[model samples]
Target: MAGTTGIIGGGIVGIALARALSARGEHVTVLEKEARLAQHQTGHNSGVVHAGLYYKPGSLKATLCAAGRVSIREFCEEKGLPYREVGKLVVAVDESELGALAEIERRSAENGVPDLARIDDPSRLREIEPHVAGVAAVHSPRTAVVDYASITEAMAQDVRMAGGSVRLGHEVTGIRSKNGRVHVTTPGSESVFDRLVVCAGLQSDVVARFVGVDASPKILPFRGEYWELAPERTDLVQGMIYPVPDPRFPFLGVHFTRGVYDNVHVGPNAVPALAREGYRWLSISPKDTWESLRWPGAWPLAKQHWRMGVDEISGSLFKPLYFQKARRFIPELKSSDLARKSGAGVRAQAWGRAGELLDDFAVDQVGPVTLLRNAPSPAATSSIAIAEYIIEHYLVKAAA
Candidate 1:
């Protein structure tokens, strides 16, 4: 609390944390490997500001997302950024999904999702999403979308104004703790800090090892690919249409989202990536692939989810198969409506050596170094609140 603070990773979460710490008069410096911030998961996402519909009640995700969305709205207003409440509809296409949909409704209610409504009548569902096909659905009118990259840029500006340095292209290479000081090394640079917070999204686990932490929670890069709706087809989705997700899988299945810019896009089918930064199928890293395969958790995780793995991989490879998944929500959808592959993001999904997904936000500390072990999806939504939580529990209170 008394010396310079180093926050690794230049994504929204890291920048948000930097903004907070700098405002508190902590000398903060952000180290990002990319030439600019928001180049990874922060920039390449569905851009939906989640409404806490899927997270477990009383969980960190639920608590932070509830607070973070409000904070994000306020921040957008203050910064004159685009914040559109396009709403979200989670549909149960058939009776088989009704029970899962009901559980989501229960969770949403307990999580206090604003203006959440359960619709059993097909007509009511049509009123919200005219083209959506579903036996039942839940509507969240307050669910919104924003330009996260823009938001992150604004936060970075605030950090600079508050006297913190946002250093782009400064990838962290090594870290050493000695005599209560953290020594961080980058190519052609070395810096010492009183406290270090690692928010390295994709390389978080790798960096944690640099701090000499356990390697149990390994980062498994899961790539989510999306497709753009044809210009004429964008109107088919009024806001966002989603499926009642499979509880066993950590993904939300392929869905339609109307971005803050008013462009509708489909997908983000989850698939394993060949590299930690793998976005496209051709962007392969033999080393990253080998490491993931060699990890103790990899085989068990695959063994448990081989069926889902096969399904997702098939969808990733075949447009027709992917179209079938999306057409479940919108029966009128044509295969051609999926104009082209728009973009993709690699998620740094963490799993235990025992083959279980690390669901909640996890934080670990090693002396003066604090590591954000697992923070995916809703992490951008919960960034500011997460920073506050870390400050209170890890930094400020720890100092006291």
Candidate 2:
């Protein structure tokens, strides 16, 4: 395709953008490095459509998550996909974390999240989750779960239906803008477009540089490893079981998520990955490793959180340590209860040179190219709204 709005990356964000543009009668082409769509972060996420609980009120995450929850549900229903509004419980294991839980409720309410209730009665807590032990909890009934991979697939189909083309295994190697046109060179071929929108997840910064943007905020891959509960222990989780997360960190702590298929998943410890696509302990790519380690953003982050980093690395190496984190929520959970090891998902967490993690989704415009630098968690939940926002903010302005 020539002279189209080229979107780099075929994750949910890219697909949603293609679908939106195509629906508006704009020519769009999506270039995906992977052989299939949603193969990385979008496909491997915990699949929870977060209910704007943890984000600060009025932030992009809060606004988009609330709006995206509605959009995702509607899209799923219309497309005849499986989804469940099974709700979530943010439990406080001790008195110290009660304040954080209260803050979450406050933020949720301020963000217009409906059906939020505080569970304090032990009997009622037991009624909702038999094995969960907590002094108090915030019950968010709007927090739901679905298969994000399926949602992405459906979005790709919608894009194709709208006359957009999705090119798989087409790795974007270069991008440049000149003479009112953006040129994108892929592994197999070269294409030019009026404008380029990149949603290149783990490789976003590199793609941004190719288009001559500063791309200063580097993408740090944090491998979230999960463990499935044994068949017999699956009964321990009913809905989503979460611990009151640390306020300083972006990670939501190790929690229990009940999958759409009725199995319970316990884990996702945020450990730094040696490789950008590193899923296993031994999985490594030399380029990804060298780039990550040498980034200016990496050293300061390491200095600030070296202790936490060491702990996370230790947990990844030892089963007992990993299970111990889970035991904080469900005390009955044994090392043996951790059965199959689920595949790892790498989060593309962006950090600035000053060592501050980018808390909200970031979008930067360089000439005719709009690059999405940091769209981490809730990006999946907020994909559609983010697309709409991008269309209104960037594409329409470019057209004008």
RMSD of each: 0.9, 1.6
lDDT of 2 at 291: 84
TM-score of each: 0.99, 0.97
Candidate 2 Cα lDDT to native: 0.88
lDDT string, candidate 2, 1-400, tens digits: 2357999999999998898888888899999999999999999889999988888788888898888989999999999998898789989988998888888878778998889999989788888888988899989887889999999999999889888899999999998778989889987799989999999999999888897778678898899999899989899899899888775574647879998888888878888888888999798888888987888878888898899998988887898888887888888878888998887899999988877898898899988899999999999999999999888888788777
Model 1 steric clash total: 0
Go through the candidates in order and give the clash count of each. 0, 0
lDDT of 2 at 2: 30
Q: Which candidate's TM-score is highest?
A: 1
Q: How much lDDT does candidate 1 score? A: 0.92
- Total backbone collisions, model 2: 0
Can you tell me which runs of candidate 1 are displaced by over 4 Å? none
